[model samples]
Target: MKLARRLQAIKPSATLALNARAKALAASGKDVVVLAAGEPDFDTPEFVKQAAIEALRTGFTKYTATAGMPELREAVCRKLEKDNGLKYAPEQVVVTAGGKQSLYNCFQALLDEGDEVIIFAPYWVSYPDMVHLAGGTPVIVPTREEDGYAPDPAAIKKALTPRTRAIILNSPANPTGAVYSRATLEGIADAVRGHDCFIVTDDMYEKLLYTGEPFLNLGNVAPDLVPRLLVSNGLSKSYAMTGWRLGYAAGPKALISGMQLVQDQSTSNASSITQKAALAALNGPTDTITAMVNEYRERRDLFVAGLNAIPGIRCRLPEGAFYAMADVRGLLGKTYKGKPLTDSLQLSEALLNDFLVAAVPGDPFGAPGYIRMSFVTSREVLQKGLTRLRDFVAALG
Candidate 1:
């Protein structure tokens, strides 16, 4: 059997791999607390589910346009105007399977062989892989934990080379939960104004912010870059619609047309009923989102403080998103249950095997001394998991 070299080189998603292991353990009657998955633990709001049911009952199962149903596109445009203060026409948007596909569409439409995309670490695990799949090189700029994992504009400028085609931005980021400041976003936008590179902003967590700080959309901040800026978002995170598999992007009409063509050949369109559900999500009441964010904020505070209380674990206070990436270097050289703990991956596996707690290693996200713990579960589960983690690390002494 033969396979493409590009496909051969790509690695499976680390998050999903860890999740499968956790599921295996759970199947064996082990009480596993999984902190590796990225989706919110909340259920889809009732109204959205009802909308999907109604759509199916009303025979909305037929295929719409390749781009999307016009009504949904209009709803998405209205959402942009209502939330981000940006204006877009239906032609500028392309609906896809999920936020992941929206990103893939951008890569497929814009990237050529040897093109370089600048990504900040610790980034979402999928960015670099997607770039590789599209035959582009991913140039990673390492950002420090002390800097909230926000990329330095100067560093981005230094990473630029003749082959650079775009820069990827993920705010309220995965793994680290680092939200870029408005000033930093403006600086990056300004730095790339004259350059010939596109700016792809993943704002999937835009509505998941817990901090009082304002989220400045790059397109809104620098309308001059609208032609080159691509904003990707979806109902998965903010609206607890992960299983619905619906995402959309807004950009220039030409680039969006390219994405539409790619979708036409690949996915064709998102699930028709899911599209109707997403329409209700976008245009319906947003109170569920606000309530979810508030609950996550409380969990974040509780979990971060609890993790820090554990000796040898130091977790930074995350401003947005639901993850707390704790630096575990203090426990690296110690022994846990008579086994030597060496790196983040080893520590994560040990926690899962010994403490029945599953977390994601930091190495996959460009850091090697930390582990990401998600607080998407209930408060009781978070407390119990923290206790188990604390006891396990304390045993190292």
Candidate 2:
């Protein structure tokens, strides 16, 4: 049996692949320090869990609406209005299996064959492939580490074309954790003023910011873009509800309807109980998130400092999220067990196989010679992983 040709252009999620490999190694009695996962180490808040329990006890297991339950959609609207300063009706909201699915739905609803979606380099590993799977071309624009991995408006403008249908922006971005500045966002808004493409902002890490400044997406800086903007968020990263599989998006009613139709024929409504739990999370206290953010700040400082202290590794301080993208170019071209370590993939393999440390290489993220490590684990685990990484680099001849 022959597979579809599209499968040839897509690769498995690099982060999840590394995580599974690390778990396999650990199950085999290897002491692997895994940092490939993007989820926080914290559990879902007790109140949220209790809400799910209540739903289960009441036998609320039947499907509701394809978009979401009205109450939850209204809760999501309230969340956007309160936190993001974006007002929307419940009609504009669509809750899906996860933020990933929300994005996938967006691409499927918006893209036709040969349509283009602009993505920044060092982006989340799933972005490019998701676009490809939707029959769209992913136009990657490289962002320099020196620029804090922030997308450049001028470069983005230059990349825009007649076929460009959308631009995906992930601030407090994954892998790099670089938050876009207000001026940068404004500039991007200005650049796209006359363009017909939509803007997709993934604010999954909005609450994990360490910077004192307020979180601002393209919508906050440019209200005009709201008409064409799709804001995707979830309870996974910020609420520590990775297993809940509840995410939502707010956009124009037409796009929401399109996404709902796509979802309606697909998974239908998300898990009924999970939606109740997500409603609780949306309306619940954010104190747990505050505590988690405070702890992650400490871990980020420790991990970045530790990475910098290692020879041939330099990591910029991430302003948000829980990842550190370390530049490992200095360690490349060195001999590892008499074979030349040429790229991030080779180096990552050496770290995992020989040193029992797991990290996602940057090649799959469109940034070679780098590796992304999550600091969501405890400081003890982070320290151990850093030490092993240091030893691995030193062992390179």
What lDDT is reached at residue 333 by model 2? 92
Error of 1 at 315 (Å): 0.8
| Candidate 2, poorest ten consecutive residues by summed lDDT | 145-154
Model 1 C-alpha lDDT per residue in residues 55-165, reported as the tens digit of each score: 999999998898889999999899888888889999999998899999999999989999999999898899999999999999999999877777788888899988999
lDDT of 2 by residue, 225-301 (tens): 99999999999998898988999999999999999999999999999999999999999899999999999999999
Clashing pairs in 1: none
Worst 10 residues of 1 by lDDT: 212-221
In TM-score terms, candidate 1 sits at: 0.98
Clashes of each: 0, 0
lDDT of each: 0.90, 0.93
Global fold similarity of model 2 (TM-score)? 0.99
